[model samples]
Target chain A: MTAAPHPGRTRRTVVLAALLALLAVAMLAGVGLGAVPVGPADIVRAIGRALAGEARVPGDAVIVDIRLPRVVLAALVGACLASAGVLYQALFRNPLADPYILGMSAGAGLGAVIALTLTASATALRFGVVPAGAFLGAVLTIVFVVRLASLRGALDVTSLLLAGVAISYVLSAMTSFVMVFFRESMTSVVFWMMGGLTAASWPYVWMVTPMLLAGIAVPLLSTRELNLMLLGEDRAAELGVDVERFKRVILAAGAVLVAAAVAVSGLIGFVGLMTPHMVRLALGPDHRVLLPASALGGAVVMVLADLVARTVLAPVEIPVGIVTALVGGPFFVWLLVRRNGHR
Target chain B: MSVRLAYEAATVGYPGVEVVSSARLRVAAGEVVGLIGPNGAGKSTLLRAVTGSARISDGEVTLSGRSLAGLTPRERARRVGVVPQQVSATFSFTAREFVLMGRHPHLGRLQQLSAADTSLAEEVMARTDTLRLAEEPVDTLSGGDLQRLALAQALAQEPEVLLLDEATSHLDLNHRMQVLDLVRELADAGMAVLAVFHDLDLAARYSDRLAVVAGGALGEAAPPPAVLTAGMLSEVFRVRAVVGADPVTGAVSVTPVLREEAVPAAGLGSVLVIGGSGTAAALMRRLHLAGYAVSAGALNRGDVDQAVAAALGLEHVALPAFGEVDPRAEAAVARMAATADAVVVADVPFGRANLGNLRALAEVAPRVVFADGFRGERDFSGGEAARLAEGLAAAGALSVPGDIDSVLAALERFTAR
Candidate 1:
């Protein structure tokens, strides 16, 4: 057996480095451009002073207390959704499959709507219970979808997608029923569904950061295993993937990541779907580079989109989800249409 | 030598219905076993039973004398590899990454490929001649390339036992040879191989032993010549396919008497075809479907002509399998040929084994026709068969292509008289 060295090794590494640099630029832009116009020099000085044990530097409150938590939460949630997106795409062996294709978003939306209305008076309950309900709803929906999708020891794509779609509609209708009966809490519910990072505090950021890290770490370990799945589940099993066990574990891991992201950011639409799909198309589907690159790309995209949400039409905030959709929707359709034309 | 993979009286099934029943076969280290049978005859089911993919309801399948039932799939995969017909890919994976995944069973969770593992995958890619295409995306690969890549992945596993289900069916002539050569090399390297093949000739050329599955069970395992008898193919495929040795390579070759499924839509009345070796295989099929109740005579048993005759269900008096043209069989064939309204001597090779078929055709000369273009080529019996064919031609017998339209016209002429 000869080494037969990988010719693209150095080229891929260089590409990765460039992506990281882009992420850094995007993060800086996210922090620098805002309604108050905190320049890069002022932000640098504030960071330097804060490192030197000065908490009262110029723009210190805006940089540290107000905007910093939101920025960090945005990065963590983006990482969570993108990594989860990679896992879901690999698990189902479908390029079009996304994190929420299996009813995760629909289930979470139902839970958020319920929890928002139930605890209008209890502010602490709103913080904890809404995320908790969303997570529970996501887990339940996925479990049901898995059960309903598999037949005679095989998962049929048509059945899985159909089941997910049907379950989503039923759960959404139930959420709508609750909303119609209780109009008083509709405004908060709608705001949560629209999705934002504005409510991100230090506590909320800390609560989900560990979950996001787990999401990123688990897929990193299974990069090769996930690559095995691209060749279909039976082939993966023959190649020693313990395919049934792998499916369960990967799906659970992906759902956990989705729970953390949706719980924090409400329902940011396209970070999970667009980031991984676009990255795989541009770069090959080697999950080793893909996992980390997507993590960075997701983080970069989320941070930049949040900045737009923060500054656009100053003082009257639009949801970050709307911006991502407005960007992803047309681009996704164009990619598909162009691919079809080429074929 | 001890067997690495052995199935004993195994009845594999889905739910309650058995697909392969009571099959007994073995593959020792350094042996290649070719699995051949008609479609749905359980060749694949037998292979699947080894990996627990199919239920082995009534028999034992052991890897190195231990049942695979006790071993986990990963443990089993560590020792056995499968190359299925089509490997569907959902992503645009490079061929190298896809082949490297064959090492998964040998590594631990969270373990990267060791330098040794990478070397093995490289060796496998080189062996499959896929190194040049290693960086190509699998989704964009041609069928042959993807098939070769699948084989390379199986080889990268470096397992003691390998199972290939129609692995080379989609490959071009060059890649087909490459894959079969690689299979031989792997066998010589002490790997056991069980390959399901539709091409009997290729199977016989490569396999150390041939396992003929038929009638819901595997027949006796033996050398290719011993197991690939005309009787077996006739019973299994319901096609009269003759088995003979290649003139050059000397490998056993199985030629189905009639390969084309294009059974003629129009049925001519009955017509007689004089066939031997593989001369009348196509003619028999054409005559049968073009509305003639097709029959042929003096065909040696276990020959291509006999097999095709059997496959087409045409009534023909066949000689004994691989022996002399006995008086009783020759007389019966002559009688049948003589009584026919018209006989067409297919442009078959004239050898000592089938000189009697020509003699029978000579008896029906006034009613006989010869297929065009082999006017003098088939004279292996010194020219005795040729002289007889020329004498019949001198008697005003027709000579034509024996194609569907031509044969139908000849049948029409015979019926008109």
Candidate 2:
């Protein structure tokens, strides 16, 4: 059944529409602020010629081939991370939970590093090997964490986070122990963990978009069950929710989402933790609105962060993760100190 | 009417520990059954067993004669609704939104609540007096309001059987009566209601029958008068109490005479009182509350003294009000007089019709206290009452000032025997 509007949906509609508009402007600014400073008219003509299947204009190769792919890839990764955040938060029933709070990012990073160090080259079939290992490692770690955190049909929130942190420390130690043998791969691993969108290309965009769609779709379809779960698990069961199966499906979807984002961009922090929270504070915690709002907010924040990452230092190229942390950390602290609880 | 819910020879437990063993009870439509026991007496466990939260290791628990184990949760929910003892939640949903969840079992898996389902929720909320609280967050409401909301949600199920476990534990007097009245109204509407109550008096007042859980077993289910006997109350609850009839509703009532509050301190023994008007009513209550085995008699039935006796649960021997004094009633009074350790004759002036009461006092021997004026009014009907009074005084009956305090002193002096 369709949801009737709840408490000021008009304002939320205005907020969402503004986020999309801001994202459009940020994308244009990102494309326009390069070494050549491609103008709006240049972007329009380049796009017109490219879509018309005609010969490229002068700046067509720069805008259509280079910047657009990078922006699209950043949007996809951002949407995936934030959408996964909502799923994990609901699954654990903890507002502090995030996509990688349960060590999915650390496991994914370890998987990518192991693949990189073992291979003779980190390029050919590199994407396939690393993403598959990362996805497998992330999913397996989630399963183990879930088992450790559950007691007699209920999940314990404190134990789930503790298990995740414990596993993360051990996995990071294992990665380091292996890294001592391969110094060249170790440098690439560190570079990857810093996280950036500079490797943006059409292939990377193709790699993350489908997963982004999947991550958003899973929560969209299960919003009702998610609402049922907001009351404790037993109450949900008494009301006829198959809680175990619901948990498994949502957990797996969240693992895939974090695994996909981390595989390509390596451990981008704060977007998954902060985007959903910001959206939840602005709109209420109705997952129907909150999930999509988080996705859109994630996309906007990631694109703007990327815009700053590529341009602010002028060709030096800061990692997008650093830019996100620089913005998100202060805002997060402000939220915690300024507000007592949800109004 | 057919039984809507039944537990037959059921043994419910967790792991190796049995909580409710060999329980046999049935609740039929249009009945409210109260389950009561002392703390740790498995009252909640028996309730949980019925709800399927605990395992029924043996025998049968049925809903409408069909085994509960065979039905799906949603199917069972459609028939039985539980008003849980407490609900704690993190999401701040409004009361209306929370109450709407009761319709979940009736809705299709993917279908949302229809207009009809919503209107039904509104109706139940209004019935529970929670309509004004519809917009308030559930967590922000007071305990009583939350309880009302819980009732609304349970009623929204339109269930045939309702289970309540200590549902009134957190309520005050007004809300407690309101909740019991609601349960009665629901039962009257062809629903079976089983409630767990810690307040035995409240249970006795509202329940058609009571099932006592004690020593890990369920006692027989019987009407309040039979189940609330003083012997059973002391054995099951370890409290010294008197079982009486409610003056207004004629329901069973319990007056606990706490051991620390009474006879042990005063050293009073069993005292029987002869009272007709309202004169000895207060004295009878004071002696009974002081933990004496107190009984009053010789008052006409349906008179002030009899009504007071019924209210205080002070057992009394009564004659038909304003009728010829019957030999059978006199015989009953004489029989009760045989067991009295002491008897106090009230300051009532004797008439020909009531001459049997003073005559009955002849049977109480060791000590009898006559009020002061019995000698002055002893000349009625050629001094016949006067003759009975002098015989009592000759039998070592002490005369008091005929006031409340002096009569109590006279009774205390008799108790010293």
> Interface RMSD, all models, one decimal each?
2.9, 3.9
DockQ for all candidate structures vs. native: 0.51, 0.26
TM-score of each: 0.85, 0.76
**How does model 2 score on DockQ?**
0.26
Q: What lDDT would candidate 2 get against the real structure?
A: 0.78
How does each model score on lDDT?
0.79, 0.78
Tell me each candidate's RMSD, in Å, in order.
4.6, 6.1
> Can you write out model 1's per-residue Cα lDDT over A1-343, one digit (the tens) per residue?
2354554466668878987898777766777778777777777787678779876855787886777778878888888888888888788776556656677877877877777778878988876887777777887888888789985467777687778778878887888798888888877666766778888788888878877777667778888788888887768777877777878788777777888888878777768778998788788788888888888888888998998898888888899989988997787667668757965
Lowest lDDT 10-mer window, candidate 1 chain A?
A1-10
Give, for candidate 1 chain B, the lowest lDDT window spanning 10 residues: B258-267
Q: Over the stretch A166-267, how does candidate 2's per-residue lDDT look in tens digits?
A: 888887787787787787677767767778877778887877877777766767877766766777665566565666778888987887788778877887
Proportion of native contacts kept per candidate = 0.67, 0.29
Model 1 CAPRI rating? medium
- Give the Å shift of residue B92 in candidate 2: 2.6
